[model samples]
Target: MTLHQQIKAASLAALQALYPEQAFELDQIAVNQTKPEFTGHYTVVLFPFVKTLRCKPNELGEKLGDYLLAHTSLFSAHQTVSGFLNLSIKDQVFTDLLLHNFNNPNFGKAAPKSKKVMLEYSSPNTNKPLHFGHLRNIFLGYATANILKNDGQEVIKANLVNDRGIHICKSMIAWQDYGNGATPSSTGIKGDHLVGDYYVRFNNEYKKQIAALVSQGMDATQAEKEAPIMQATQAMLRDWEKGDENVRQLWKMMNDWVYEGFNNTYARLGVDFDKYYFESNTYLLGKQLVESGLANGILYQKEDHSVWVDLSDEGLDQKLLLRGDGTSVYMTQDLGTAKLKYDDYGIDQSIYVIADEQNYHMQVLQIILKKLGEPCWKGIYHLSYGMVELPSGRMKSREGTVVDADDMMDEMIVLAKEQTEAAGKTEGFSDAELQDLYEMIGMGALKFYLLRVEPKKKMIFDPKESIDLHGFTATFIQYAHARICSILRRENLPIMPDSSHFQGFVASEKLTDAEGKLLLSLEQFPEVLKAAANEYSPAIVCNYAFGLAQLFNSFYDNHPIAKAATDEKKNLRLMLIVMTAQVLRQGMNLLGIRLPEKM
Candidate 1:
C-alpha cells in the first residue's frame, strides 16, 4: 500500500479503538498533505469524528494523535490546529522508501488487473484531414488509456472510422464534377487534404446554387432542399447502399486515400488502435437489431416503413433508427458498433471518448439499448469532453477554416528550433540530433498543453504559451530531467545508482528540510498514478509531474549533492535525483512525450 493508504488505514484503526461503539470506514478518514504553513507531512481531519462523538475538536484530535504516536513508528510528532491533526512522519521512513525504490524503473506501476476495458477515440470522417479540434480528443483518449494500462487494467484501444456517409459523398461529387482527373499524386497534395479541398468546393458551389434558386423567387428553405449538389449526394448515397458497382468503386478509392493520410498522421502522433470498426460493415447489423426490436415490441414502425423508438417515458424524444427508404442513420451504426465491440472482446467497460455535444445522443443510446435488453448497455460509458476552440473562435470544417494537424505540428517544430537557438542551448549537437530533439520538444509541448486541462472544460489553444520552458508545460519537466542527466554524467556516476553506493547511510541520520520534502514527493508517485486512473483524467498525472519537477528544482537550488559535507549525504542526494529523473521519464512517457538527455 502507498503512504497515503497506510495513513488512512491507521487513522481508521485509531478512530475505531478510541470510540469502540462508533463505526468507521477507511474512506471516511480524510488524509491530505499538510500545508506548508503547518509542521507535519500529512494531516487527518478531526471534525468528522468530533461531531459524531459529541466531543470537542481539539480533544478528539489529541486522543487520535496520541494513539498514533504510541502505537506505530510512522510519526515522530503531532500537532493539532483548528480541528486538524497533523502528523510528522519519521525520517527513517522517507530514507527507507528512497533506498528501496530508487533503482526500480517500474516503481509506480500496478500489477495486472482482471477487469478489461475498450477505449474508443479519434473517430474521424473520410472527407477531411484531422484538424486542431481533433487533437484534444485524440490526446486525451491516448493518454487516459496509457494511464489505465499502467494502473493494471487490461485495455483495448479502438477506432471507429466513419468511412461511409453523405458528407463523404459530397466530396466525391465535387471532385467528379470539377476535377480534370486530379489525384493526390498528380496534385502533389496529401490525400486527406486533397479530399478536404473538394469538400470545401462542394459547400461553396452548394451555397451559390441556393442563392440562385432564391433569386428566382424560391423560398430559402425550399432552395436548400432542392439544391442540385444535395440531390446528387443523396442519390449517390442511395446508389452506394444498393451495391452499385461504380459507386462502390469510387467510394472505396476515396476512402483508401483518406485512410493512408490518417495512418501517417496517427503515426506521427504515436497513437494506434487494436481494433478498427467501419460504418459500412456495421450498419447492416444495426438494421437487423432494429428489426428484432420491432418484432419484440421494444420499437415501433412508422406508416412509411421507417423505424422509430419512443423514449418519451425515459425523458427523451422519439429517435430514428432507419429511414423510410431502408437507409440507416448514425445511431444505427453506433448501436451495431457497440454490440460488435462487446461480442469481440467481452470487455467489462466500453468507453467512448466523444465531445460533449453528443451528450444527449449518448444518453438516448444507452436507454434504447437497455430497452432492447442488450447486456452491453450496462457497460456503455461516455467519456464526454468539451470542444477545443481557438482564440479566434470555433472552426468550421466545411468552410476550410480549421488549422490542419500537420501544419500545426510543423509550426511547433519551427517554434521549438527558434526558442532552442535563442536560449543558446543547441551547442554540441549534430544536425540529425537537433532535428530529433526539436520534434521531441515540439510534440511534447503540444500533447502536454492539451492534456493538462480537465477533460470536461473547454479550452483555447495558444501555441506560443504551450512551449514556455518556465511554465506548467512539458518543456519544463523535460528540461529538469536533462539537468539531472547532465549532473550524473559530470560526476562520473551511473545513471541508475546501485544500492551499494548508500551502504554507509545510517537510518537514524537527520534529514534536511529540502531532502525530506523531495523524498515525500517521490513516495507519493504510486498514489498519484492510482488517482489518475480512477478519475479517468490525464490532467492529474500532468499536475503530479509538474509539481514533482518544481520540488526537485527547489531542492537542487537549496542543497549541493556532489559537494555535500559528508559522503553519506552525497550518496543520499544522488539517489534522490536519480529516482526523480526516473519518475519524470515514466510520467511523461504515459502522456506520449519523450524526454531527451540533453535539450
Candidate 2:
C-alpha cells in the first residue's frame, strides 16, 4: 500500500471506533497533507462526522485525534484544532516511502482482483477523414482504457468501422459517375479527403437534381428525400450479397482506400484496435436476435411487419428492432454486436466509450440486454463523455469547418518547433535532435490539453492557451523536467551518497524551505495514481503532474541543489530531484504524455 492509503486507512479505523453509527466511507474522509506554514504533515476534516455522531465538533476531533496517534506509529506529532485533526509524519518514514515509490516495480499499477472489461470507441464513418470531433472521441476512449487498465481490470480496446451505409454509397456513386479513371495520385489529394470532396460534391449535385424536380411541380420535401439514394444503395448491397462480380469489385476497391486512410490517421493519434466489427458483418445478426426475441415473446410484431419492444412501463418509448421491410437499423446492429462480443470474450464487463448524446441509446440497450437474459448485462457501462467545442462553436463537418486530426497534429508540431526556436533553446541541438524535441513537446501539449479537463465537461480547445508555457499545459511540465535535467548535468555528481559510507542522512534546520515542501509533494505520487484509478479520471493524474511541476519550480527558485554548502544536504536534494523526475515520468505516462530531457 502507498503511504497515503496506509495513512487514510489508519485514520479511518480510528474514526469508525469513535463514531460507530456514522457511515465511515473513505470518500467522506478528506485527509490533506498540511501546507508549508502548518506544523502538521496531514490534516483530516472532522466536520463531516459531527452531525452524524451528534457530538460537540471539537470534542469529536479531540477523541479521533487521540486515537490516531495512539494506534498509528506513522505519525510523529498530533493535535486537534477547530474541529480538525492535524497530524505530522516523521521525516524518515516520509523519505522511505519516497525511495520505495521509485524503486517499486508496481508503483502505479493496481492489484488485479476481479473482472475483465471491453471498451469500444472511434467508430468513424468511412466517407471522411477524422477531425477535431473525432479527436475528442479518440482521446476519451484511449484515456478511459488506460484508467481501467490501471484499475486492475483486463481492458480490450475495440472499434467498429462504419464501412457500410448510404453515406459511403454516395461517395462511391459520385466517384464512379464523375471520375474518368481519376485516382488520388492523379488528383494530388489524400484518399479520405478526396473521397470526402466527392461526397460533398454529390450532395451539391443531388440537391440541384432535387431542386429541378421541385421546379417541375413535385413536393420539395418528398422529392429531396433519400429514398432514391437508399433504393440504389440497397440494390447495390443486394447485388454485392448475391456475389455480383461488378459490385463486389467496386466495394472492395473503395473500402480499401478508406481503410488505408483511417489506418494512417489512427497511427498518428497513437490509437489501435484489438478487434474491428464492420457493419457489413453485424447488421444481419440483429434480425436473428429479433426473431429469437419474437419466439420468446420478448417483443411484439405489428401488422405492418415492424418488430418493437414496448418499454413504456420503463418510462421509455417503444424501440423498433427490425423495420417493416425486415431491414435492421443501427440499434439492431448494436444488439448483435453486444451478443457477439460476449460470445467471443465472455468478459466480466463491457464498456462503451461513447458520447453523452447517445446516453439514452445505451440505457435502452442495457434494458433490452437484461430482458433478453444476458448474464453480462449487469456489467455493461456507458462511459458517456461530453462534446469538444471550439471558442467559436461546435465542429460541423458539413459546413467545411472541421479541423482534421492529422492536420491539427502537424500544426501543433510546427508550433512546438516555433516555440523552441523563438526561445533560442534549440541552439545546441542538431536537426534530428530538434525534430525529436518537437514531437515530444507536440504530443505532450496534445495529451495534457485533453487529459487535464474532466471528460464529462465540455472543453474549449484554445490553441494559444493549450500550448502556453506559463500555465497548466504539458509544455509547462516538460519544461520542468528539462530544467531538472539541466541542473543534474551541471552538477555532475552522484545524488545518492553511498549509504554504506554513512550512519544516516539527516535534514537540518537549513533545509526547511520549499525543498522540504517539494519532497512531501513527491511522496504523494503513488497516492495520486490510486485516486485517479478509483475515480476513473485521467484529469486527476494530469492535475497531479501540474502540481508536482509547480512545487519543483518553487523549490528550484529557493533552494540551491547544485551549490549547497554541505555535500550530504546537496546529495539528499539531488536525490529528491531524481525522485521527482521518476514521478513526473510515471504520472505523464499514465496520461499518454512524454517528458523530453531537453526542451
What C-alpha root-mean-square deviation, in Å, does candidate 2 show against the real structure?
A: 3.1
Candidate 2 local lDDT, 280-373, one digit each (tens): 7887887888888889999999999999988898999999999998888888888888888888898887888777889999999889888777
Task: Estimate the lDDT of model 1.
Answer: 0.90
Model number with the top TM-score: 1
Q: After TM-score superposition, what is the CA distance of residue 352 in candidate 2 from its true location, in Å?
A: 1.2
What local distance difference test score does each model get?
0.90, 0.77
- Which 10-residue span in candidate 2 carries the lowest summed lDDT? 493-502
Off by over 4 Å in 2: 12-30, 33-37, 48-56, 59-63, 103-105, 226-243, 462-469, 491-513
